[model samples]
Target: MRAAEHRRELVTLAYPVYAELLSGVTAGIINMVWVARLGGHAVAAVAVATNVENLLLGVIFVAGSGTTVLVARARGAGDRAATHSAVRGGWALWAVITPVVAVGGYLCREPLARLLLGGGEGGSLRLATGYFAIALPGIAVLFATNVVDGILKGMGDTRTPMRLAAVANGSILVLDPLLILGCGLGVRGAAIATVLGRSAALACGLVVLHRGRASRRPAEAAECGIGSLGADARRTARTGLPMSADFVVRMAGALALVAVVARIGVDEVAAYGIATKAMYVATMAFYSVRQAAAIHTAHLLGAGHDQRRAVGRQALLLSGALGLSALLILLTAAPWIMRAFGSQGEVAEAGALYLRCLGPYLVLLACFIALGGVFEGSGASPALARVTLCGTTLQLALAYGLSGWGLPGICLAMASSMALQCAAVGRMYLRTGRMGRTERPPATGSEADRPWIPAAAASDETH
Candidate 1:
């Protein structure tokens, strides 16, 4: 693709993804708004439950992301059999995982509730259990929707999934009040509303998958060695596991960093939490770009191009612009942002300080994350995952060692680690550019399932 074309394609794919992510945030906010009418305990209940749901999302990525990469690659290769196998693999993985979570979770609702709320018979626990009783069972709908989204994105149509999210979350915004207050189901009503909205969306998604452009390929085309269902599942797992681990590792590291912040002071911890939450606005934008890059990279690779260098450059440019914009916003508006959150005194001061110091980290993170997408799409995610683990560990150690300086120290630690990650990714990018289309050794089993290969590798040519 030309420079202009790359920009256009990346933007075309990215904006809808950004909208989809924002709608998800909107759904949570809508739920919170309605639940707040019940009381603080009810709000607390929904919050904790949603946090757990977020973690569960990571589990589902094993299927969703795996399917996306495989399908995109297949589409690029014009391999209908591989596309079919990829779709089946995603569904197969979902089927195996959903029952364990949805069924087992319902049976242990009370214990799970207790675990999140620290074991109490308080109103929060009661409300949490009530919410889980409905939400846990509804995990099937969520899983199916996610799989559908993955399949569509793999087909190179991100717009439909974005529209689906808007439709489902939009319904939740409309139904939450009617179910929660008007229908008198309380917290359980919120869960029901969410499930109903998502189920409706899922139904729409299935229809699209059956009739959409993604499914239009002729069935009698060459198989291109698409694996069997079980093999595909394992391959999908292998391809996606590193991406999943990267997410989980980041989450775990963030949580651990909170503990490190606690060593400073309670006020600092509160400020750190609030500042981090605020940072998500910027971070999610970076991630949106990352997803766009991944999808585009995979699609191009499947189509027999190795434009990782070009893709990486464009991704960095896009994310770097956004990151710089965020830096300016945070720098100029940190005080007002803290006040907007109703923070006061030391909390506001500390948060502003952290935000001001956050610029370097955000810029580095945007570059790293966006570049990491190329690695993911090209089946080099294990390396990215290793870098993430190393960076997270280094950040925590530095944070703990620099706790005396409070939030500023934490920001410095984060920036330092991110810088290291960027450096590592840069080296890999240079190597890929130099190597061009050199053939790699043939992979076995799950690794062979990866659809991406250098031109030589795919063409059966020896190096």
Candidate 2:
């Protein structure tokens, strides 16, 4: 049996990373809540601008994804030289990538905002452009933070980023009004505040890593050891690429869904803003488990554990629990949660109703995420990306079609899509037999499933 403390250590590391992600998101939701009253135009602007930002975030996600794989494997293998080398290489790459993203964001801001917001003459286009312009230059901050964060995550240090996120979000809370209504910054102010918060997060992460300092002592201390960063960037690239693809493609589809919603009118957009916010809170546990399971599975795969099946099973089980928990929260909090966000009774009612519809489908959402862990662990990122492509495409198509039916249509569309996506992914996963100890039939298994087992060498045992 695994030591109680060992299991807890894994859980502990995952907690802060999840919290960091959720807290920053919470801050965004609160910010959006206040923005909703400013006007639907403003809400639409923020949504489009945020989606643009997420697009950029998807690009850098590969860097973090690569870092996590490198860190997990190197540390698992006790290769101190390789770990430090990777740390240095990661920093070097970000120095180049950050500025590139920032400049691109700055230049693309107006056109992209116009496109996503659909450029109405109501001055909404100008407002969204304003937000996007300011948000664009801060790409450097966002890039730097995520890259450093990936390194930290690889090291099993989720809390460092989480604490930093809290600081960043707190700054946003303080700076939002100062820039927006106070100095007459409006959307620009909000954008600036977000940028500064990201910069702060990057700064905190830098300090944490430098202090932790890479060591070539894996031969001496089992835990602190890491392999050389001498591994090909291409390999890291190959590993992380699918993860980035999944995020980027899925986000692209999400934005497309938003664009469709925009056509339904700003009121629908505002309603969605409120509902999505509530949904995120209700769904944090799912996000948390998926992230934790992915990282843990990566480490386990690296360590050559014999329990791939067990790990996969546990991750999925955790995901189901999380999804069920989200459902209960959605069902129970549907009314009050909506009421808390928007002052408009109809908006609140619509959002609450939407949440209730989304409740059961949380099951599908969680399971899909669990499957992502398997792909990440096995380094079959192509599979991971394909899974995302199929699921998101289906979801997007449904969302686009159902949106014409109004609020319920939008909710049902996405929820139903999630169900279909999960089933598709789960079926493929079972067929692959990557999750289990034996190359047993998937109840009926992917081409990768064979009689051969890639066992960790006898000398590589962790404890």
* TM-score, per-candidate, Cα-based: 0.92, 0.81
Model 2 segments more than 4 A misplaced: 1-10, 29-44, 120-123, 181-184, 213-231, 259-270, 343-345, 399-416, 431-454, 457-463
Backbone clashes for every candidate come to: 1, 14
**Model 1 accuracy (lDDT, Cα):** 0.84
- Candidate 2 residue-wise lDDT at 8: 58
* Candidate 1 local Cα displacement, residue 73, angstroms: 1.0
| TM-score of decoy 1 | 0.92
Q: How well is each residue in 260-289 modelled by candidate 1, as lDDT tens digits? A: 999999999889878887898899899889
Per-residue error (Å), model 2, residue 400: 5.1
RMSD of candidate 1 to true structure, Å: 3.8
